[model samples]
Target: MSEEVGRTAQSGWEVGVSRTLPYSGARLWEFLLGREGVEVWLGAGVELPRERGEAYETANGITGEIRSFHEGTRVRLTWRPKDWDHDSTLQLTVVGQGRRSTLKFHQEWLADAAERAEQRAYWKDVTERVAAALAER
Candidate 1:
């Protein structure tokens, strides 16, 4: 992996994906941020806390803590991998569209070239899976 040189080194990688969820922005945020709801979609046994700074853990061991939330609009969390940078944050944006909503994903802090490339695919898959699961419900 090529290490980023310079101040931009800290900026990290940012990838975004959009999906249509059959729920409103408020409903979408509730499901993504809820413990049971997260487990049903984000991951198994996922524990997502509503309070900022609170950590969300899952059975697969992916843990993310709340960094910030904007009611039914956006939610930002620092997803910490045991072996990766703890500063990484995944920002999720929810856009209301009539009775449904558009979900946008922004995964930042993915630096290491090798890891970034892998995650570029992983995040896309994750978002697609989420959309499919939501579509089924």
Candidate 2:
């Protein structure tokens, strides 16, 4: 599911998407944090450290800094496409037990309603792709 909260001007807007997958949190976390796993959904290679304040770049030209990291559970980062004027904050939370998992993703600090809507659609598609990839694994 997906949702958007608050006005774009007041708090930069917030967009969230969630998905349930047939994988463990550790598995999903690897996909989200590991370079090989990122390539599956993002269509790019990412160079990132698992520590705060480290820079990361994707082959698709997206760049950001790691804001926070909690191994096998959560990651927060600053995300900016090559064309965006500024960066946005994105947080990914994984909750899972055994072989089932739920991923909650939030991206805030968007520029406007348009950007929020755009990202909502973008993430929905991306997360769906992620789910499909996990299923194949």
Candidate 3:
């Protein structure tokens, strides 16, 4: 059998979407954690705790816990929609060089290939929206 896309023995199913933005890592990091960017990336009403292991819930009914956070670099966390039976690991990363940076959204431990594809599309749309929003500023 052919190996499945985004499948791994350790992580099960996964998906990643990224976009290169014309911004610094520090700037993108701040925006991503800010209220407006939180709504764009995470969800509305999400106020992530500063400490690891702290739990959070969004207005749309998703729940998760913080795993780790690296200032101006990346954040790793657990993500679970209200209807999902299993939790997934999500990592947001920004790597900047010179005047541009690449923002990455990576999620793993999904239930199956279908969910992987679904999340892939979701993140792609999110990347586009984020790019547009940043361009306006």
Candidate 4:
């Protein structure tokens, strides 16, 4: 069988979504890592730790462990909702050039195409929420 659009030999099914905003990378990074923004994108009522191997669970019961974190640039973690049977890797990156910044969300290790599609929609919605919040600033 031919591999699907987001399927990879190493990571399995995956999805990625991004949004560019009219803010500097530094500004976007600050907001993305800030408490309010973190709750929006990451989860509600959880402060993501900077150290790798740190585990966290949101107020809503989604759990994850930080795999890597680069100050002001990116973070990688393993995420698993309470209902999920396995963990997936998620990476968020902020790329800034001049006055604009691009926020990227990538997830891999999805179970199948359905999971990939679901995550794609989920990330798109997340980007929209993030964008809307920034636009209000």
Candidate 5:
């Protein structure tokens, strides 16, 4: 697991978590953007369309709108939990070769130190689950 936390002059605090997976970039993209794939790894049903301004929500009630999308490459979206006062931004990027890929995930505009820590742990666990699910495939 590779993780970083930093303070940005304009964004307050940001958290990043990255992993290198033994899967092709396309495979990883499928796992992230495909309905069945997300349901298995994230443990929630998602309605995601790879288009700007498209809305998405998890079965558990997390909601967001797509900010940017590049097929098989990257996705940037607004992520807002039901209780959050403001939305945070999440970006997922993938780069890889024939059979391996590096996944970079970054979340910014956190509210405070406590929220930062909480998000760090949550993302860590989520990424671990994703990797495990990929391995099982």
Candidate 6:
């Protein structure tokens, strides 16, 4: 099935969201795994062993696909949540901006309007918390 196929037993679709963090790209990747990392961000529900192709999981039962991981630089994964039929593509990017860094996040997972709305709310909450965490450091 293509990426657009509906869930195994569903008739609806979902949407995705893009968010930006206050920190540079490198720190965002690191923060997802550091002690304060899990405590601050929404990704990395489960710890990634920092190896490509390792099976990672989230606390919410979302298994992850560590497609690309570069020590302290970047990561892209397939994030699966029990509530959705398809796993969204989650990507992280770190870039230098002036005197600071920018963390860019893109998530393409969900297949229903309602699900998209709910996921948006979920990310909004996480974004605020993550911003604070990055600010403190």
Candidate 2 residue-wise lDDT at 109 = 89
TM-score of each: 0.75, 0.87, 0.96, 0.97, 0.89, 0.67
Give candidate 4's TM-score.
0.97
lDDT value, residue 99 of candidate 1: 81
Positional deviation of residue 56's Cα in model 4 after best superposition, in angstroms:
0.7
Q: Candidate 6 residues 71-124, lDDT tens each? A: 655677777876656777666555656445665555564666566676667766
Query: What lDDT would candidate 4 get against the real structure?
Result: 0.93
The global C-alpha lDDT for each of the candidates, from Candidate 1 onward, is 0.71, 0.81, 0.90, 0.93, 0.82, 0.62
Query: When superposed on Cα atoms, how far off is each prediction in RMSD?
Result: 3.9, 3.7, 0.9, 0.8, 4.0, 5.6
TM-score of 6: 0.67
2-77 in candidate 3: lDDT tens per residue? Answer: 9887999988999999988889877888888888888888899987776799999999998999999988888999
Lowest summed lDDT window (length 10), candidate 4: 1-10
lDDT ranking of the models = 4, 3, 5, 2, 1, 6
Candidate 2 displacement at residue 10 in angstroms: 7.0
Which has the better TM-score: candidate 5, or candidate 6? 5
Candidate 2 C-alpha lDDT tens digits along 1-137:
45545455545777998998888888898887676666754448775568899988888888898899888888888889899999999888899878988988889988878988998898898888788877776
State the lDDT at 17 in candidate 1.
73
**lDDT by residue (tens digit), candidate 1, 5-122:** 3214445666667888778877787766666456644577766666898877767767878988787788788776666655577787889998899888777776666666666677
> Pairing residues by index, what is the TM-score of model 2?
0.87
**lDDT comparison, 2 vs 6, better candidate:** 2
Best by TM-score: 4
lDDT of 5 by residue, 41-118 (tens): 333777676789999888877888999999899889888888899999988888877899988888999998788888
| Model 1 lDDT, full chain set | 0.71
- By TM-score, highest first, what's the ranking? 4, 3, 5, 2, 1, 6
State in Å the error of residue 63, model 5.
Answer: 0.9
